[model samples]
Structures are given as C-alpha cells and as structure tokens.
Target: MHSFKRVLVTGADGFIGSHLTETLVRAGYNVRAFVYYNSFNSWGWLDQSPEEIKRELDVFAGDIRDPHGVRSAMQGCDAVLHLASLIAIPYSYHSPDTYVDTNIKGTLNVLQAAKELGVAKIVHTSTSEVYGTAQYVPIDERHPLQGQSPYSASKIGADQMALAFYRSFGLPVGIIRPFNTYGPRQSARAVIPTIITQLAQGNRKIKLGAIHPTRDFNYVEDTVEGFISFLESSRSIGEEINIGSNFEISIGDTARLIARLMNVELEIETDEIRLRPEKSEVERLWADNRKARELLNWQPAYGGEKGFEAGLAKTIEWFSNPDNLLNYKANLYNI
Candidate 1:
C-alpha cells in the first residue's frame, strides 16, 4: 500500500463520501474533507457522524467547480478522492445546464488542479449509468459508454475528461465506477431509499417507476471499501475499475425482497413522474468484478444474492429508525 501524509476527499459531506471519511479516520489516516459551501454552513451528512469522527476531520468548505478553491483544498494533500457531482437523473432532466456545470466542469477543475499540484494519486468517481441499458450482462471496464440521460451524459463527459488527463498529462488518476450503491444516508431519489422510506412510513403501496430495470447493487460500506482500495493501490493508477456486488435483480424483485425482510405486505404502484423517458431507461446492469479483485484485491463483502438481502436488511434496520425516517418525505415522489 502506498502511504500518504494527507488525503483529500471531495464531496466529503455526501453519502458515500461521509462513510469513506469516517472509515479513513478510524483507520488512522490524516484526512481533509472538502465539503460544498452553503449559506446554512451545513456539512450535510457529516453533521450526523459520530463525534469522534467529526473531531478527527479537517473540513474545507468549497465548490468543486471553482478551480481556485479546488487547488487550495489540495494544497497539502498528496492524494484526492473526487466524488463531488450533481447525480440525480430526474433533476438532470429538469436542469441539464446544472448537470453540465457540476458534473463536467466540476471534474475539469479537479483534473486541472491535480495536474498543476502534482498530486500523487487521484481517484475519480463514475457511475454504471454511463453504460446505458448494458448491451451485455456483467459489464466490465471495457464496456462501451452510452449516455441515455443528461445526468449520465455529463458523467460520461467527466469520465472521459479524467482519462484524457491521465493520457495527456500522465496524471496519476484512477476512476472507480460503482454500480447502484444503497444503504444508510442515501438520498430518497434512489430507488432503494425511496422503497425503504415509504415502507418504513407505513405505506403498503410503494411507489416506483420502471421496475423491470435491473441493477447491480452494492452496499454503501462495500463501495467505501472500494474507494480505499483504489486509493492505496499503486496498480490502480491510470486504470478504470468497477466496484460492485456482481449480482443482478430487477427493481420489482428488490422491492419484494425488502418487503419480505421488513415483514410487510408490499403493493407497488407505478409513479408516472418517476419514470425516465423511454429510451433513457437503463434496462439492466450486472457487474464483472474480477478486475477489481485481481488489481486491487478488492471484493464486495455484500456480493451475490444472499449478500444483497443481508445488505437490504441492514439498510431497512437503519431507515426503520424514526429519527432517520423523519428526514424523508415518503408520501411524495422524490423526483
């Protein structure tokens, strides 16, 4: 494992980023958390983190789209885990401009800053959505990218920009493309959280769209572990790796599984507003994780069918808590 004095985590206040930050601090790494600046001075999910983890973090509030701020955030850090981006697919449909600014330009700022700063390693986040509808089962890193939505399109642009930096400037950048990650603190916009929050709120009739679409779901902790694996392995440099559970299940089946786990009789109702434009829907996704296993020696603790159920149980337990459930508006459509 390569050692670094300080590692910067962009989007540190977010779901996966918060989990990764806490894990790194617990593992005894010097971490600088770069959170988005807001008028309320909110640190997002970090505000809910354990006191010990909060105390260990050195928080830097800045915008990823600002090159100056990004450079300043990376000043003393040897490596960076860039996870800042606008990721809601539905919101992207409403505002494609914001997605372009946040996803594409935000990544460009990180790339330019990392190149100039001589950062030792950079791990950029990518999504499986870029592989629209998965032309084949078990998508590997070599799969062709198809941007079916504005959100996925922006991410595709960002991923290409990261790769271009690696090729043109020889920047030590690695991309960690994670499949659907769900667990505690995930936004309601995602299908899993939407399903869980609705059921936990005593709604037997769950609302969703495009239930036929299959996804390769990875638990949040597993995704966090993938980030750390990529961060430490010198072999990950210049490589694009997938972090996924290597299992496939349709949204409808996933909802039924959650209902069984929660001991609730489920009735799924299609929410028209939640449906993506016909061609924009990614019908299927299953991961081939052999590359991550061989290159980074990484494997999802939550892998395969049984592992998915176990992960869902853990997620349900968390969302079942009244305090957590109160944060979501289960009665309304998330997007």
Candidate 2:
C-alpha cells in the first residue's frame, strides 16, 4: 500500500472525519485537519480528542465553499479526504440551498484545488441515502441514483461533480460511499444517536420515524479503514466504492438490538413529525460491498449484531456522561 506523507482531511471536526484524522496521524502521515472556521477557535471533535491525537493533528479552520481557503489547505498535502457537507435530511427540508452550496459547490472547489495541488489521491465522501429506497437489494456503485430528500439530492450532485472532475481533468479521485456509519461522538441527528441518547437518559419508550426502513450500518472505524484502503489502491481512481457491511436490519430491529444491549425493553413509538414526506421515505438500503472488497480489499470488521453491541456500549458510555448528553436536544427530534 502506498501511504501519502501528508494528508488533508476536510471536516476533521466531525465524527468520521476526526476518527480518520487520528488514523492518518497514527499511520505517520502529517495531518492537516480542515474544520469549519469559527471565532471560538474550536476544532470540532479534534478538540475533544486525546492529547496524543490532538498533538498529531494541525487543525486549520476554514469553509470548504471558499476556493481560496481550500487551495491554501491543500498546500503541501499529498492527498485529500473531503468529508465536509450539510448532512441532516430533516434540516435540509428547511434550508436546501445551503446544502447545494456546501455539498455540491464545496466538492467542486475541492476537485479544482486538488487538480491544482497535484494531489496523489482525493477520497471524496458520499452517503448511502444517494441510492434512495434502493430499487434493488445490495445496492452497488452502478445502482440508480434517487433524490428523495434534499440532503440526498445535494450529495448526489456532489458525487456527480467529483466523477465529472475525474473524467474531465483526470483527477485521481475515489468516492467512498459509506452506509449508515454510527459510533461515539456522532451527532444526535442520526438515528443511532437519537435512539442511544434517548435510552441513555433513562427513557423506556423511544420515538422514531419510519422504523420499518432498513439500513446497512458500518461502524465508524471500519468506514475509516475503507477510506484509507481506497487511498492506497490504484484501482480506486475514478471509482465509486461502497464501504458497508453486506447485511441489512430494519430500524425497528436496530432499536431492539440496542435495547437488548442496554437490557431495556423499551417500546418504540412512531412520531408523525419525525416521518418524511409520504413518498420521500427511503425504505431499504443494503450494500453489496463486492466492489469495495475487490478494489480496496476491505470488508466490514463488525457486522450488524456485534457492531450494534459495540456501538451501543461506547455510545451509551459517552452519552451517560453529562458532558456528552448535554450537547443533545432530546425533547425535540433533530432533523
């Protein structure tokens, strides 16, 4: 595997980004973490990382939407991992233009800068939601794209833009489409965090939307590994690789597994407010992962049951502490 000496990671303040930043650092690569700029000088989750990990990362605060700032961040970096974007589907309902600006336009900016920087590889982040309500089980890279939600639409645009760069300008870009990654430090907006946080606060009953929909969840670490593997593979260039477990479980069953892990028999309640527009709901997402395995030689280390057990243990432990749980708005559903 060819390891880049310096790697730039956009959105390093986020859950998956932070984990990937730390992993890159551990691999002896100098890490430049591009986090959203704030007056507070807060480096998102990087600030919360252990001192060992924090010291290994040089956090650069900037907006991915700005081409100048993105180019500056890419300077001296051998590769780039672009994970910054607006991802909350519910919030996308209220404001979608911002999603387009950040997700689609921001991706264009990254591709342009990477082209100028002569970066070895550009690992672009995509989401499973882009294959909305999968027309077929075990959705592969060739699966049809759907835009049921504005968030998914924006991501689809971004993914298309990334591929366009590769085809038009020969940019060494690979799209890592992760399926429902969940773990510690995840925002409460995600279903896993929403469920785990509710249970952590001693709630016996949980409110959720469209529990019947199934997703293939990959633990954050495994997803990160997929990102790294893609970067190290020559075949991944211009390829859209899926990083997911070849398994599926309904959100209802997922909640049950979490409850079992927590040893709580919580009743699941559906909230109308939480449901998506009648037809917009994505009913099922199962990943084939054959391309990922063939190209990157990566497979999920944790499957559904074990991943749930491990994730719930870590997430519950984090949420149990007031410092973490206090960050959530438990009373209202976060879109």
- Please, what is the whole-model Cα lDDT of each candidate in the order they appear? 0.93, 0.89
- For model 1, residues 1-335, the per-residue Cα lDDT tens digits are 34989999999999999999999999999999999999999999999999999999999999998889999999989999999999999999999999999999999999998889899999999999999988887899999999999999999999999999999999999899999999999999899999999988889998899899899999999999999999999799889899988899999999999999999899999989889999999999999999999999999998989899999999999999999988888888877
Best by the TM-score measure = 1
- Stretches of model 1 off by over 4 angstroms after superposition: none
lDDT of 2: 0.89
What tens digits encode model 2's per-residue C-alpha lDDT throughout 26-91? 887788999999999999888888899888788889999999999999999999999999999988
- Cα error of candidate 2 at position 32, Å: 0.2
Estimated TM-score per prediction? 0.99, 0.96
Q: For model 1, what is the error of residue 193's alpha carbon versus the real structure, in angstroms, after optimal superposition?
A: 0.8
**TM accuracy, model 1:** 0.99
Instruction: Tell me which residue pairs clash in candidate 1.
Output: none
